[model samples]
Target: MGADERERLFQRARECSGHRRTWSEADRLWTQVIDAYRQAVSGSGRVDPNDRRQLARALWRHGMLLAARGRPAEGLATGREAVTIFEQLNDAAARDATDQGRDEALAELITAVLDLAETAFAAGEPVLRMDLLDRAVAAGLRTAGPPPSAGPRTREAMGTAYHNQATALLHRCLTGTSPDEDAREAALAASRACELRQRLMDPLRPLSVWEMANTYGLYAQCLTLIRDLDRAATVLDLGNRLVELLGPAGAQPALKLRVAATMLARERASARGGTGQRRWGWRRH
Candidate 1:
């Protein structure tokens, strides 16, 4: 079956299973989607550029996931293929290729770079990660020309790219058997991600609860990983508070779960040490 058909089947399964229940159907479809993408790249001449870009994005994401799940070589190679397609679209000067073609392709390139970075990181190559991220940011500047406006595709893509890069840096630092300097750099990178997300949320005005919660939640988690538990707790609260406002527009269950987990993690961290004092110490001390 085609990717769309596979997606339809997955969605149907989800709908039948009730959105709340765990179902492997979606996972199966996504797997098929990634497989299809890889196959297309082998004979990419038949695929249209726009379709190639979308499929490339899918392949990159799934490849990273597979890498994280322990197929680093396959995942990294898939990411590399996707990166090539993203570069082509980014070089395009037409809307047929990008919704905001100029910046969209750039955003795609940024995304591809981030994927490559993560895949490389998983494969134990920090130097590769750093190099890809550097190119991602530079290419992003060319394609992502302006700050985000409501519904502006490029802006969101840019924000996503920034968040991805920062998160990769966070993982690289946290998981390494490394020196303090490396950890410190990772913390700083995560902080930059937090700041950029804050700005992205602000301009949209009356930001949705989901958006606020996710942004703050990621910051909280990053802070927690860096041993800044107190700041993490505060950010976790901010994220929870936004849930009420976000109720109307609907929210993503996955992000909601992350928010929940962050709150639990904060409490756990607070309880571990001189509980009450650490709760408010990071900012002051």
Candidate 2:
């Protein structure tokens, strides 16, 4: 078949993959899609960047589906392959001196890296996950540019990358061997996540508000871990305010903020050699 036929197969696979009920069909279609691309390359005796990108995209989606279907090890392997392809494409784009191609490839690379990081995390490789997240953050920054100049898609990708990085760092701080360093790094990541999400927030978008509130809670948790009680309190307050503004849609972040507030109070109490009161009053409606 031709490139157009291959693309149609890819689209069919994507559509099948969109819902859980059709995942088995998706898996079948993806295999066909992958084979089609490989056949094209073998027959042509040369690699096409566009073909490689489509292959990588297919691998990424297939990996996620595999993970969702309880085959995480396979998912991780596939995701790594996808990331490798995306990285190569991104590097080639960088050397080509075309801003459009470079940016597009960088965006794709960041997404692939981030997805692979999540797969690694799920596969119980926290260190590997963190490394991939760091790569994603770097790529996201380059693609996103300054906050003022970034388009919505770039801003969203950057915000997600920062948010995931901060969450991973915080998890390491709470559970890994390097509490101090992880907490500090988490604070930085959480701060950037908050900044990016803040810029994206709109009162009309409850999901955006919720995301901002959750980032605030993460920031507060990082601050509390570092014993920065004052700043933690401030961050918690900001989260709570956003929750209040969001009403019932904000319940998840509200709970997160409350937990962070509680942690902050405990830290303060430890510092003062006394039981800390609930000084950060959460108003009830």
Candidate 3:
């Protein structure tokens, strides 16, 4: 295609890819961009780094839609591909050129990795989730560039890691020989993440942070597991109160119910000849 045609095609693909109203449309646009790049290779003549970046972005969106729709494995595969291509293009960019391109690429990779972690944990593949979380946390903390600050996204990523870890531990608790120690550690991390979120959310304080409530509840959950009913009750009580203050009405009924059930379960466990609390040494982080 001529220069005019190529530019138009690229612009059209971008517009299509960015339309978030429908997932199917996003997929269609991403497919077109992918097809456009398929005919051109690294040394196959005139190549645009911008075009390469766009293609990666398209694939990222398409993969996101897939994951949202419950096709996590497919989403993860596509996201990995996008991360690979973007990393390449980002590195290939001239130093004279703005690092915005590289920053954007890395940001997309972070997102994809986080999504993959959540999905893996949900699917009971905690190993995969843990690996992704490890990479994300390390990168988030160590990110150094012209941008100076790691940005709010880094905190968000860390929060997500903690959330997924808590979930994986909970899954293990019900499905395996939980061993106490494992559950305690996960719960402690979850609580620390909640504290971090509170500090980060301070600017929006009074706006109410339901996510924080949820995080705090994770610690309460761990306490419940170890027969620390009083502490567990206190933590969850505060969390439920925050949930109420958030004014989401029905955003967390199920979670609240689960907490309530846990409280009742703790009571039953205590009544059933259970003595001596088990401190799995799961120090609250």
Query: Which predicted model would earn the best lDDT?
Result: 2
lDDT of 2 by residue, 17-101 (tens): 9999999999999989988877776654668778988988999999988888878789999898888888888888778837667
Better of 1 and 2 by TM-score: 2
Model 1 weakest 10-residue run by lDDT: 276-285
Output the lDDT of residue 146, model 2.
64
Runs with alpha carbons beyond 4 Å of true place in candidate 2: 45-48, 97-100, 140-155, 203-207, 244-252, 269-285
Query: Across residues 60-138, which tens digit of lDDT does each residue of candidate 1 receive?
Result: 7656656756777777887887888777776764444435556556656776787788788788887787888777766
Greater lDDT among 1 and 2 belongs to: 2
Locate the minimum summed-lDDT window of 10 residues in model 2: 276-285
In order, what is each prediction's RMSD in angstroms? 7.5, 4.7, 6.0
For TM-score, the strongest prediction is: 2
Worst 10 residues of 3 by lDDT: 276-285
lDDT of 3: 0.62
Count clashing residue pairs in model 2: 0
In order of appearance, the predictions have TM-scores of: 0.56, 0.81, 0.69
**Model 1 off-target regions past 4 Å?**
1-48, 54-65, 94-99, 145-151, 171-188, 199-211, 218-236, 243-285
- The lDDT for every candidate, in the order shown, is 0.60, 0.83, 0.62
User: lDDT per residue, candidate 3, 1-285, as tens digits?
Assistant: 443554566567556645556556656656765676654444568877666766676666667666766777887788778767755653564244355644554555566667667766555577887787766555545553322254454455566666656766665665567547766767676675766667666526643376677676676776677566677777776677676776665266337536644654655565575665543333231
